[model samples]
Target chain A: MHTLTDAALVGVVLASFLALGTSRLTSCIRATAIQGWLLALLSVAIHEWPPTGHTFFIAAVSLVMKGILIPILLERAIRQASVRREVEPFIGYASSLVLGGILVVTAFGIAGRLPLPHQTSSTLLVPTALSTLMIGLLLLVSRTKALNQVVGYLVAENGIFIFGMSLTREVPLLIEAGILLDVFVGVFVMGIVMYQINQEFDRLDTRNLNLLKD
Target chain B: MLRLLVLAPAAAGALAFLLRANAHRLALLVAVALLHAGLVLGTWTALPPADLDGHLALDALGQLFLTLLSVLFVPVSAYACAYLSHDTGRPNRTFVGCLLFFLSAMTLVTLSQSLGLLWVAVEATTLASAPLIYHHRSPRALEATWKYLVICSVGIALALLGTFFLAMAASDPRSGATPLLLPELVLLARAHALSIPWLRGGFVLLLIGYGTKMGLAPLHTWLPDAHSEAPSPASALLSGALLNCAFLGILRVLHVCVAADQAAFAQDLLVVLGLGSMGVAAAFILKQPDYKRMLAYSSVEHMGILALGVGLGGAGVFGALFHAVNHSLTKALLFLAAGNLLLAYQSKSVSDVTGALRRLPLTGVLFLAGFFAITGTPPFGMFLSEFTILSVAATHGRYLVATLYVGFLAMVFIGMGNIVLRMVQGDAPAPAASGHGPPSSHAPSPAAASRESWFLTAPPCCLAAAALLLGVWMPPGVHAALDRAVAAVAG
Candidate 1:
C-alpha cells in the first residue's frame, strides 16, 4: 500500500512537470487529466483499511469532474475559441523547466519544516502537493493564452485537492462535494467567458486584454 | 430565517427569468429587495433562533453587512428600474435575474459560518455578477466580463486551497478529524496549539484570494475594466455591496488567526497590503481619464483604508467597521451619480463630459458631495472613521502607517478632485445639451434642461444624505453593534 501510494504520488508530480514542459494545449490538458486520475488513485491507496463509502464516492466524483468533465470543458473552449494548439507561454519552455526544478526543491524544503498532523502513508504527499501548486502558479504567470491559464488554474486546484486528501478524515463529504460543484461552475463560467472573448477579439490571447489599463 | 435570507433572492432570480415585461420584472426586483430587508430587520429585532446545523448564522459582523446590503439594494434596485427602461438595445431579463441572484450570493457570503461554505458563496457571487457586468454585450463589456471571470475564479481557487490548508492545521492526530467550521476551528485553535505555520500560510493565501475579490492592488487588475464597462446600476452594486462581502470573508479568517494567537502576522500582512493598495490607487487616480474608472479607483483606496484599520487593532478595527458602512453609502452614491452622468453625457470619458452641474444639477451636486465624503473630508461619515484610524495608529506607535494613511488621503483627494472639479464645472457641449449625442435616443427630451427623474436621482441623493447623517450622529444601537463586531475581530 505504501509503495503504491509513493509511486502514484511521484506520478502526480511528474504529470505536473509534464504540464509545465508541454507547449501544446491539448497535451497540457492531457497531463492535467493524468494528474487528476493519479490523485483519485492516491485517494483510495492512502486509506489504511478498505475505503469507506465516503472515500469511494469522493474518488468517483474526482475521476468524473477533474478527469473527464473539466477536460471536456477545456477542449470545447479551445475548439470554439479557435486558439492555436501552442501554449505560447510568456516565459520560454526551457526556463520553465529550470524554474520548475527550483519549485520542487523549494516545495520539499517548505514541506520539511511544517510538520503534518500525523505520519502519512506516503512521505512524499506534502512535497508533491506543494510542487503541483507552485507549478500551477508558474503556468499562470508564464502562459499568455487564456485557455492555458484556465488549465493552470485547474492544475493548481488539483494540487489543493491532493493536499486536502492528505487529511482525508478531516474534510466532510458535503464540503468536498461543495468544493467540486464550485469548481465545475467556476470553469463553466470561465469557458463561457473565453468563448465570448474569442467572439470579440478573434484571438484567445489574454495579453490583448491590455486595453483597460490605466 | 437564515435559510430564507439565503434562498429568497435565488427564488426571485428564477422568477425574474420567467417574467417578461421590464416593468414587472423590475418591480419583482424591488419587492424582493424590500422583503430581504424586512426579513433582516425581523431577525435582528426579534433575535430568532439560528440554523440548527451551524451551517448558517448571523453574528454581529454579519448582521451589520446584511443590513448594509439590504439597505443599499433598495436604492440600487430602485435606480435599476429607471436605468434599464432607458436601454432598448437588449432585453433585461438576464440582468434583472442576475442582480437578485448576486444579492443572494452576497447574503450567503455574510451569513456563512463555515469556511468551506463561505468559499462556495464567494465563488457564487463571482458567477452571478459576471453576467451583470456583461449586460451591455458590447466587445468592451465582454472583455471586462472575461477578465472578471478568469481573474476572480483563479483568485478564489487559491482561497479554496487556503481553506483546505486551514483545515489541515486544525487536524489533530489524536482526534483523527476536525471540522472546517469557523467557530469550531476557533475553539480548537484555542484549546490545542494548532499548527501556526499552516494557519499563517493559509491566511496569506486567503488574503490573496479574497483580496482579489476585494479589489486590493496588484490583484485588482480586473476591477477598473469591469466597473467602468458595466452599466451604472451594476457598477453601483459591485463597488458598494460586493466588495464588502469579500471583506467579510477575510474578516472571518482573521477571527481564526486571532484565536490561534498569530494575529500579529496576519495584521502585518494586512497593513502592508492595505498601504500598498492605497499607493496604487493614488498613482492611477491621479491621471484617470474615465469618470467611472476614477470611482472604481476610489473603491480600491477605501478598501485599503478598511484593511489598514483592521490591521491597526483596537480603534482601527472600529474605524474600519464604521468606514465600511460609510464607504458603501458614499461610493454607491458616486457610482449611481456617475451612471446618470453616463446616460446624460452618453460618454464615460471625462473629456467628453463637462458642466455636469449645469446640465444635471442633482446628480452633479451629489457626485461632488460624494467625492468629499469618500476622500475623508470632515463632516462626512468617512472623515470620522479615517480620523479614528489615524489617531489609533498614532497612539499605537504605528506612526509610519498613520503618516502614509494621511498622505494617501491627501494625494487621492487632489487627484480625484482635479478630474471631478473639471467635469462638474465646465459647460455642456451643444450636442450633449440638445440630447443629440449617442445613447441619447432613449432620452425623451432634447432640451438643455436637466432630464433627472425622481427614480434616477433620488436613490443616490438619499444615499449621500445617509452618509452625511452617519457622520454627525452614531445611534447608540449602531455604536453597540460596531463594538461587538470589533470584539469579534480584535479578541
Candidate 2:
C-alpha cells in the first residue's frame, strides 16, 4: 500500500511534466485527469483502516469531478474551438522539457533544506508536489493557447491538491472539502469561459486576443 | 456584527440582479453604498472596544481604511445612479449587480483579520469587477475585459501560492501550532518563523502578486486599458476601491513580515519597486494623449508614492496610508470628472477637445483640482502626505533616496500639468461648441449635451472637497487612528 502511494505520487510529478511537454491539447487534458485520479487515491491512502467518510467523499469528488467532469468539459471546449493542437509554443518543447528538469531538481533541493518536523514519510511527495507546481506554472507562462492555460491551471491546482493530500492527516475534513469545492468550481468556470472565448473570438488562441494592449 | 457588515452589499447585489428597471437597480446600488457608509461610521463606536477576530479583526489600520472606502464610495455610487438613470442596451441589472458585489468584496477586504480570508476577498473583487469593466461592450472594452481577467487571475494565483508558503513558514512551531491566523502568526513571528527563509520568499511573491494589482509598473500593464475601457464610475471604483483592496493585502503580508524580523529586507524590495513604478510613470506621463488613460497612469504614479512612503517607515508609513486615502478620493474624483468630459466632448484624447474650463466650468475646475491634488500640490491631502514622507526620508538619512524620489515626482507633475493646462485653457474645440459631432455625425446619445446632468458634475466636486478637507485638517479620531497604526508598525 505504501509503495502504491509512493508510485502514484511519483506519477503526479511525471503527469505534470507530460502536461507541459505535450503539444496536443487532448493529450495534456488526459494527463491532467490521470493526475487528478492519482491525487484522489493518494488522498485516501493517507489514512489507514479504510479511511473516514469525509476522506472517502473527498476521494470520490476528486475522482468524479476533477478527474471526470472537468476534463470532459475542457475536451468539449477544445472541440468547440479551431485550435485542436499546439503547433509551437513561445518556448519550444525541448526547452520546456529542460526547464521542467531544472524545476524538479530545484524543488527537491529546497525541500531538503526545509526543517519541517511532520510527515517525513512523505518526503518524496513534498518535492514531487512542489515540482509539479513549478511545471504547471511553466506551462501557464509558456503556452499561448487558452485551452493550454486552462490545463496548466488544473495541473497547478492538482499539484496543490497532491500537496494537500500529503497532509490529509493534519488538515481538517471541512477545510479539505472546502478546498476541493473551490478548485472544482474554479476549473468549471474557467472551462465554460474557454468555450465562450473560443466561440466569441473564433479561436482558442489567447495570444491572438491581444487587442487590449496599451 | 462582522458577518452583517460583510453580507449587506452581497444581499443587495442579489436583489439588484432580480430587478428589471435600470433606474431601480441603480437606486439599489446607491442605497447599498450609503448603507455601507452608515454601517462603517457606526462601527467606529466599537473601536473603543478594540475589535479583532484572533487573526481577522478591525484594528486601527483596518478601521481607517474602512472609513476611507465607505466615505469615498457614497457619492461615486450616487453619481452612477443618476448617470445610469436612463440607458440603453443590456440591462443596468448586470452592472448594478456587479457594482454591489464589488462593494461587498471591498468591505470584506477592509475588515479582513486573517491573511487567508483577505486573499479570498481580494480575488473575489477581481471576479466581481470583470463584468463592470465590460459594461460598455465595445470591441475595445471586451479586449480590456479580457486583459483585466487574465492578468488579475494569474497575479492573484501567485498570491495564493505566497499565502501557502506563509503557512509553511509557521509549520515549524509547536506551541503556536494548528491553523494560521494573522494575529497568531504575528505572535509566531515574534519567536519562531522569523528566521525561516521560506517566510522571506513568501513576502517577495506577495509583493509581486498584489503589487501587480496595485498598479505598480512592470506589473501595471492592465491599469491603462481597464481604466480607459470601463465606465467612468467603474473606473473610479477600480482605481479607487480595488487598488486599495490589493494594497491592504500587501500591507497585511508586510505586517506579518515586519513581525518576522526581516522587515528591512521587505522594505528594500518595496523601495525598489516603488522607485521603478515612479520611473515608469514619469516616462509615460510625458506624452500622454488619452485623458482617461493619463489619469490611470497618474494613479499608477500616486500608488508608487504610497508604496515608497510605506517602505520608508517612520512618519513615512503614516503619510503613505494618508496619501492612499487622499489618492482614492482624488483619483475617483478625477475619473468621474473625466467621465463627464467624455460625456460632454465625446472623446478621451486631449488633442481632440479643448477649453474644458470655458465649456464646462464645474467639471473642468474639479478635474483641475483633482490634478493638482494628485500631483502633490498644496491645499490637498496628498501634498501634506508627500511632505511628511520627504521629512521622514531625510530624517532616516535616506537623503539620496528622498531627492531621487521627489525629483521623479516633480517631473510627473510637469508632464501631467502641461497636458491639463492645455486641455482646460485653450479655445473650446470648434466642434464642441456647435452641434457638430465627434469625428462622426452619428454619436451615441449618451454623449449628447442632454446627458450632462448633475450626475456628471456633482460626484467629483464632492470628492474633491473631501480630499481638501482631509488635507487641511486631521480630525480627532482619524489622527488617533493614524498614530496608533504608526505606533503598531514602529512597535
Candidate 3:
C-alpha cells in the first residue's frame, strides 16, 4: 500500500483550490484546516522510512499549530471583528478564478523545464507547490479586507511549507521547524495588527490606508 | 569572536533595560557601539581567522561590509545619544536597547555564512528596528512603523520561501546530505553547474524578495514613509547601513549564480528592476509635497543607480561600489540636515515652509550644501562616483541605458531643485502661516533656533566633510580595496 500520505496531499491540494474558490470565509478556513492536516501527515511520513525524528516532531507541531490552533485564532479574530460578509473585493470572483487558473498553468509550465530527480515519486510536487503559492497571491491581491489578506498570507506560508516538505531529507528537518515557527510569529503579528486596524477604523477595509501617498 | 559582536550589544541591551539610569545607559550605549565597531574593524584589518559553526563566516565581501558598518556606525551611534535627548519617553531604555539589538542583527546579517542564517539575520533586523522607528509614538511614526513591519515581514517571508526552493535544488542530486553552507554550495555550484537552472529561478525570487527590502521599484512603497518618519540618525542607519545589508544578501545570491555561470540571466533582471525604479522616482519627484519624502524618493533613485551600475558589469561594478559609499555618506548628510530644517520650520512640506535661510542660518546652509552634494553637483563624492558610473556605461555599449539614466537624473534635479530653492531662499512667512498641525507640533523656541546644538550639527558636518574629501582625494590604499571589491564582482 502507498499509504494515506500521498492521497492526503492530493486531498489537500483539492481543498486548497476549494478555499481559493469558496465564497464564504468560514468554509475557506475549514478547507485550509484540512490542508494543514494533509501537510502534518506529509511531514510525519518523511521520518517513518527515513527515521528523521525531527520530522515527527515537526509534524506534531504543524498539527497543533496550524491545523488546530491557527484556525481557532483566525475564527476568534473574525468573531471579534464581526465581519461575516463575502464583501466586495478588488477583483470579482470569476476573474480571480481565471487569474488563478492562468497562474496554475504558468507554474506547471515553468516547473516542466526543471531537471527533476528520476527516482522521485512526483516531479509534479514543485508545480503543485508553486500553483498553491500563486493562488495565495491571487487571494491577497484580489481581496479588499485586511483579515482576508492575513488569511492569504497564511495560505502562502502553507504552500511554501508543503513545498519545503518535499525536500525534507536535504533541508534538515530542524530548519523546516524554524521556518514554521517564523510563519507562526508572522501570522500572530498580522493578527494583532488587524485587531488594531479594526479598533482604529471601525471596519476591516485595508484600502482606506491610502493616507500615506505623496 | 563573531558571537561577541552580537552578545556584547545584547548584554548591554538587557542591562539598559534593568538599570533604569538614562545617563549611564547612554554612556554605556556609546561605549558598546564603539567597542563593537572596534571589534569589526580589528577583525577586518587583521583578516582575523575564525568562523563560528560554519553557518557564519567572514569572506572578502563580509569583511568589506563589516568594516563599512563599523566605521560608519561609530559616529552615528555617538550622535544617537544626543539625538534621543529630545525624546520624551519615560523608559529611554527601550530605545537604547533596541539600538544595540539592531546593531547586533545587522552584524549578523553581514557575517552570516549560510543563506538561511542570512534570512534570519535580516528579519531580526526588521524586528529590532520597528520600535526604534516608533520611538516618537506620534501618529505618523506609528503608521510608518506599522507599514515597515508588515511590508518587510512579508517580503522576508517570500525570501524564506525562495531559500526553501534553493534547498530543493541541492536535493535533486543528493539525498539526506547537502549542508546549507555557502562555501560548499559555491564550490558545488562550480562543478555541478548544469543542475543549477532551478537555482536560477530561485535567484529571481531571491532578488525580488531582497530587492523589496532594498527598496527597489514597484516594491519600494514602504521606504519613503519609513525613512521620512524616522529620526534622522535612524534614517542614517537605514540608508547608510541597512539597505546595504539587503544588497549584500542579493550579492551573495549573484555570486552563487556567477559560480554557476548563470550571471548573464540575473544581470538582465537587475537592470530592468533598477531602471524601472529610477523611472518611477522621476515620475513622482516632479510634484513631491513633503521635503523628507522627496529625499526618501531620491534615496530610491540612488539605490536604482547602484543596481544599474552593478548590472552593467566590468568597470560598472567598480563605479557602483564607489557610488554605494558616496551615496551612503551624502544621503546621510542630506537626511540629517533635512532633520534640522524640519525641526526649525516645524514642517516638512515644501509649499508651507519658506525662506529657510532667513529663519535658520545653520540648517539652511547645511540643507543647501546637502542638496548639492546629493544631486551629484561638483566638489562632492557623489558627483565623482556618478561620473565613474556614466563613463563605465559609455565604455560598455549600454549607451541607451546610459542616456536614459542621465536624462532621468536631470529631470530629478530640476524637479527637486524647484522645491529646495523655493523652500530655502525666500522670506520667512508669518508664524500664523506656519502649517503646525496640533497634537504633532514641534515648533522650536527662539533660543533653540539661535543655538543649534553642536551634537546635531557635528554629525552632518563630518558626513558632508567625508563626501568632500572623497571627491578631492581618494587615497590609493582605499582605492585598492574598492578595486578589489569591484574585481571580485566582475571576476
- List the candidates' TM-scores in order: 0.95, 0.92, 0.91
Model 2 C-alpha lDDT per residue in residues A1-214, reported as the tens digit of each score:
6787889888888888888788898999999899989988887776685778877888898899888988888888888785678986999998999999999999999879866646645668778878888898899889988878878777776776565444323544444564566566556656655665666678777766776544
What residue runs in model 3 are displaced by over 4 Å at the alpha carbon?
A: A21-37, A47-50, A60-86, A92-110, A121-124, A172-178, B11-28, B87-94, B135-146, B172-179, B192-196, B430-435, B440-450
- Candidate 3 CAPRI-style tier: acceptable
Residue-level lDDT tens digits of model 3 in A1-214: 1355557656766776776676677877787778788888877664347646666787888988788888887787777888875578888778777787888899889778766643444555677777877787777777877767766776777777777756645455445665666666666656766666667677767775666777
Give the 10-residue window scoring lowest on summed lDDT in candidate 2 chain A.
A166-175
* DockQ for every prediction shown: 0.62, 0.36, 0.36
Q: On lDDT, who's better, 2 or 3?
A: 2
Candidate 2 lDDT, B1-491, residue by residue in tens: 66667789999999998988877887788788888888887777765332344434677777777788887788888888755543333578888998888888888887777666676777778778888877776657766776776777677767766776677677753554444577777888887644467688778878888998998988999899999989988899899878988988888888888887787998888888888898898888888989888888888888888889889977788888888888899999999888877777777788876888888888889889888999989988889999998898999999888998899999999999989988889778665354454444325463444435777688788898889998888788777888876665545
Best by TM-score: 1
Output the better candidate (1/3) by TM-score: 1
Q: Candidate 1: misplaced stretches above 4 Å?
A: B432-450
The CA lDDT at B130 in model 1 is 95
Of the candidates numbered 1 and 3, which has the greater DockQ value? 1
Instruction: Give the better candidate number (1 or 3) by lDDT.
Output: 1
Native A-B interface contacts kept, per candidate? 0.66, 0.14, 0.23
Docking class of 2: acceptable
